[model samples]
Target: MTDLTDRVKQAAAAAEADSPPPVTDLAVTDTALHWLQSRQSYFTDALPRHVDQAHFMSVALSIMPALVKCTHESVHTAFLACARFGLEPDGRQAAVIPYGDKATFQPMYQGYIELMYRHPRVDSVHFGWVRERDQWDYTPTEPSPRDFFHKPRVDLTEDERGPVILAYAFAWIDGKRSQVIILNRAQAEQIRNKYSGAYKKAERNAKRDSAWHTDFDAMWAKSAIRRLVKVVPTSHELAELLKADDDADDTTTAPPVIRGTVIRNDDQADNADNRTTWPAAAEPGSGATADTDGGEQA
Candidate 1:
């Protein structure tokens, strides 16, 4: 009888150990929704008028599990960026990527074009990668009226098109191509090696998870667009968007604080005027249609 009792006790203990944890607590999604709902006004005020709160909440909830794995503060900062930029965390326009316990908000190249169109001055924006097999030409002239042309080879498969040799971004203003910027493969690599801390870390670990590795073409185009934004006239919001991306690239520094819709960098507190401010919501039906010249790879 003593032996049987001991055996039964051991069996019960083993079963308990093998069983899953009880579902007594609220799920990550539920908790995140509750938290977001509690601060609904804060997020709603930051979002552009075109993006409804209900839709944003649904998208946020879809990614809540991943966001919950990150530190609470980091999650808040990431969502703050999402709301302010009016980009969804749906992995298209923007994404909240996890770096160990911290999460960073990364706006996709599409997101850049989206915000560019929000500028009343911008008529259209386009970014494309030049393949080694593609016919490309650019002739820069004095003062104004530069010539540019590109014809990607249709006979070749995407891989057969060969490695990307160049990336370019162009913008139309007043119904004409007013600004153009191009980056060669070498220059794009230099920018990645210099500014992408994530790329460096991935190199050390022999991992190819960084965007620089997974989406080289997109990053290449983005680099060109980033350069174009500097020379072209853009809104304060567009400039801030670039700054936000720059901050994400520099992982060595502490994350910026989101103070009432402003992304204030603690290290740059002396330059308070350069802080990011929430842009006014775009007018309904004024958003520009996305350019279909090049589709961003998933």
Candidate 2:
């Protein structure tokens, strides 16, 4: 027998020795493998890709009591029950990606973050440096302990569906997450467009979670930040005033800005997806103040 088989046998024997006669021991076999595979496919394929990972598994497992109660239900009926599961407070707070070509794997990350903590969106992930010593200090004495200090080992969920994942991490896992989502390009694009600059999801093979790689980080650091950049700290009047005060004597270049578009014609700008070009300076009161570049007319 293989070492794994031997290990299973020894483990089973130990369990039997420690437990009361009434308790059952798990047996490993081909039949067990087949059952596991079938259960896994049902949970995974039943849901729409739009569903985040947490809700997907939760919905799938909720049917177990039904499966247990109605053992006679056809396997097809049992499988369909997962898709039909309804969540109250519809669309509560999904970290939805815009439907687009680029966001194919966004939901996986959304699910991953949701699985770890109930954050509202990917933009809200709090990432910062942690000292190596601090990390070591938190290590537990045993592996896979229930304590948070142990840090979770990414693994298959109890429902047999795949573990929640992030596109960042999926790179290290050989694009499995992308492969899963790419099955529906429409769904993937929807996510990609919304989170266009949200993640550094590269076309290259994914090798890890988080954009630790130079190219990976570069994408988010530049593009994502442009998206993340909130409205310029103050309105144009305040911004211009602050600029004048700070550079009372200096004549250096201006601060970088993500957005500075200001359209005076509310009606035209509101209806148009187009942006009006601004000159360094427009004729005074032309309702064109592009010249006062404290950022933009906006």
Candidate 3:
């Protein structure tokens, strides 16, 4: 057999023979290192290191399960971002929700946009967040001319003349038509409440932190975009990679990471400040919208 194949078999045998009781202590074999190296093209940022030896072990344990339920390609793509975002690995997908938290596992804004356009039928996807103007506004980005025919529309509606924190827009298309949906501060909170177990730890901190209180617009936008991809005509592969998110941490159904295992300034720590905080706008002097190439958007 080829050297690489032989190395992988040897590593698997070692893992099976001495599988440590602490999942986090499992080694990152040469095979996994090779896998990570081979998938570099799929990522944009440098992948974050494991928070500790335990975190590395958890990642090692995750590899086999990811490969089994998620196809090799799917697990590879999911890990590309998971490593970057320091997300906990689920079966086919990865979790953004901190261990034992109740809010859904939403991706970082950049990851959210990337997964959207990764949809084969998706011509393009753009994101906007609430601004200081007492209305929801987004960066005014134009899709490529080829996509102008079915550009997704983003806008807000009025209820009683007061700022409608809740807004709906046509954010996605199935290559056939568009889908209008609602994304608002209320919905995000509702989601958090629905997955209350996951937020129990964060909710206590949110009461003290202005960061969480002030960033609802960006948070709502991400929540909306994540929901949009699942309901639309994305690739089956992309969908499978994200499917585990539907009821993340709501029950014992999820794969476990090191729960109650705290590391100071831990990369996996769920602090609001350490989390994905959205900037007020994507660019200065640009309209309320942020344009990104499936990466960071305003």
The 10-residue segment of model 2 with minimum total lDDT is 96-105
The clash tally of candidate 3 reads 12
Top model by lDDT, which number?
A: 1
After aligning candidate 2 to the native by TM-score, how far in Å is the CA of 237 from where it should be? 42
Over 29-95, each residue of candidate 3 has an lDDT whose tens digit, in order, gives 3333443333333332323343343453355344442233222333333344454444544422243
lDDT of 2 by residue, 102-219 (tens): 1011112222223222212222332221222222122234332221131232353323432222221111122111111111223334434454332234323352222223233233
Q: Which one wins on TM-score?
A: 1
Whole-model lDDT values for every prediction: 0.70, 0.27, 0.41
Q: Between 1 and 3, whose lDDT is larger?
A: 1
TM-score of candidate 3 on Cα atoms, chains taken together: 0.38
How do the residues 230-255 of candidate 1 rate in per-residue lDDT, one tens digit apiece? 76667877877887887887777777
lDDT of 2 at 279: 15
Clashes of each: 0, 22, 12
RMSD of each: 14.5, 27.2, 20.6
Q: In candidate 3, how many Å is residue 244 off? A: 3.6
